[model samples]
Structure formats: structure tokens, C-alpha cells
Target: MAEPLLDIHGLPGHLIRRLNQIAVAQFMEKMGEIAVDLTPVQYSALCAVKSHPGIDQASIAGLIAYDRATLGKVIDRLEAKGLVSRKVSPQDRRARVVKLTKSGQELLQQVHPVVRAAQGDILTGLDNVEQAQFIALMQKTIQIGNESSRAPQRELGETG
Candidate 1:
């Protein structure tokens, strides 16, 4: 007989919190093996810059669902570590565009496989079909969330 433990399956919020912690912890552990000290948030910021070259700071923060103040600290940390550069956008004087330096790109390439392996480990319990389904569900959730975030605000006088 299986030993009784916390009913994590019955608590979606608890499950999500635990899963996020576990995933992040495992990923960080793997990153340690590669001597990469950057946090997940930093890595995500770098990835945003990598995928969208010359993206503005505000846009990157929005894309990652990070608040401006927190994202600013992440950018500052990355800049201090020499992983990214922020330049005044040529098209928009008030905006600062971000990009990964050559060293940042190389570091990303080196650590990406380790990151993938860590993610794969998190999914090890799931079979191929389950893994695919899980990914599809996550994408769907993100799509719905994005749509909600982008929905226009209603005027004060407007009726539902």
C-alpha cells in the first residue's frame, strides 16, 4: 500500500506552486553545472532579446509579463554581468532597445541544451503523447491569458 501524503492532486494552486518551484530549482541546479549564475528571469530576458532583436525594454517586459520596475532590475543585472546591451532606439528617442552581446549569444547557445535537458527531466514522468498534450495545453493557456491581457478596457458609461 502507498503511504499517505499531502493530497497535492486535489489542490491546483498548491500543485502549480510546487511544480514551478521544483522546475526552477532543477533548472538552476543544472545551470550550476555549467557555471551559469543567472536566474531564470534573467535567462528569460536574454531569450526575449535573442528572439526579438532590438526590442525595447517596455516591450520585453510586457512580453514576459514582468512589471516595469522588476524588469528594470533584471536588465540592470544582465547589463552588469555583460550579457546584454541597451542602446537608445534609433526609431524612438525615448525608448531603449535591448540586445544580447556576442558573449551573451554564445553563453545562451552553450546553456540552452542544459536547460532543455532540465526541462526534459521535469517531463520524464509523462509519455510522448502526454508530453505533447501538456505542451499544447500550456500554449492554449498562454494564448487565452494574452488575449485577456490585450482586451480593451470598457468606458465608464458602457454597459456589459
Candidate 2:
């Protein structure tokens, strides 16, 4: 008997998608426990802005591997939350530069430990060594397949 395609247990894409869902759920649950109201993408944006203060919105999209157009909405939400501030870029008047505000920095610091702890739950069945190996493998796979993604991650200094 031919195996059913609907049985996606052995499929990498299906597995990866499931893992992503689990990761996001764990992240949101942990954040909720800590009383922090931030999505994974928003948290990534905050980290990117913190790392490269005054970076343009397009660069942030690249850094975080998020769709550039959609990132605008994400930034708007962050701005509305008073976590980040956006200003017209000095070098490019048309571009908006983003910076994490004091509140954003403080919230990030407060939630850092919670976020780190939440990582363990994402791969709950994996032990310490297995988790490290899985992470390394995932990184390598992502690096190899990055260019194939609709929103591929790019180095901060890389130009399109």
C-alpha cells in the first residue's frame, strides 16, 4: 500500500512549520506570563533596532527577514506602543530611521531572561546537547535556503 501524502510526519517542511508554530506559541505564552505584550516579529524588530540604532526601515526589514511592506505596519505598532521612535533619515529624506526608545530598552532587558527561558520549551523533548545540535542544523539549513525565501535575511551592510 502506498503511504498517504496526508501523513506529513516525515516531511521536513511540515515539521519545520509545526516547529515554528510551537516556537511562536511558547514565546507568546512566556511573554504573557511576564506581562509583556509583544509578538515575535516585534521583539525581533526591537532587537534589530537596538543593535543598529537609527537604521532605516528597509534595513530593519532585511535584518529581520520580514517583508518590507509588512514591516511598516509592525513599526507603526511599535511606535504606537511607544517602544520605538521613527524619524526621517538624515541621509535619505524619503527613508525612515528607527531607534529603540528608553522604554523599549528597559522592556527588552526585563524580558530577556524570560525569552531565553522560553527557548527550552520550543524544543521540549530535546536535551541540552540535542538542542544545540538541532539549533546548529537549523541555522545551516536556513543559511543555505535563505535566498529562496520571499524575505531572505541580509547582512546589515549588504545592498540589494
Give the top-scoring candidate (TM-score).
2
RMSD of 2: 2.5
TM-score for every candidate vs. truth? 0.82, 0.94
Model 1 residue-pair collision total:
0
Highest lDDT against the true fold, candidate: 2
Q: Write the per-residue lDDT of candidate 2 for residues 1-160, one digit (tens) a residue.
A: 9866687888999999999999899889888888889999999999999999999999999999999999999999999999999999989999999999999999999987888878888898899999999999999999999999999999887966
lDDT of each structure? 0.80, 0.93
The lowest-lDDT stretch of 10 consecutive residues in candidate 1 is: 151-160
Q: Which regions in candidate 1 have their CA more than 4 angstroms from the true location?
A: 1-9, 147-160
How big is the positional error of residue 147 in model 1, measured in Å on the Cα after superposition? Answer: 5.1
Pairs clashing in candidate 2?
Answer: none
Model 1, residue 69: what's the lDDT?
77
Tell me how candidate 1 scores on lDDT: 0.80
